[model samples]
Target: MTTKSIPDILRQSLESHMAEADLRDDDELKELLGKLNTLSGKVAAAKAQVMARRSDKKR
Candidate 1:
């Protein structure tokens, strides 16, 4: 069986639904993901901090 590659439209949709994530092409997507991967921990930490602040303000 052969596997099909992901389409650009699907990638665009996914990125739009993500954290304002976007890319111009497959190569750009690859590069963007690589950079994001390296900053994943920081991203998660920042998200958690923002969430915590929101929760604290709500209560």
Candidate 2:
């Protein structure tokens, strides 16, 4: 069986946790939003690194 990718696994886990949380509470929602932003930044950086490596291989 093929293994799930890191991004896919992270997205699934985040969705599951978000569904369980009380988003109606402003404080909790704000915290979750902050965490999401941090995760997004990390994912973007990882993508950039992968792209850079791919470009280097062509040189």
Per-residue lDDT tens digits of candidate 1, residues 1-59?
A: 43322343444455775645443446767676656555654656676798899999999
Off by over 4 Å in 2: 1-25
* Alpha-carbon deviation at 5 in model 2, angstroms: 12
TM-score of the candidate numbered 1? 0.39
Which stretch of 10 consecutive residues in model 2 shows the poorest summed lDDT? 1-10
Worst lDDT window (10 residues) for model 1? 1-10
Per-residue lDDT tens digits for candidate 2, residues 1-59, read 44555655665576666688823446865576667667867877887798899999999
Candidate 1's C-alpha runs over 4 A off are 1-35
Top model number, TM-score: 2
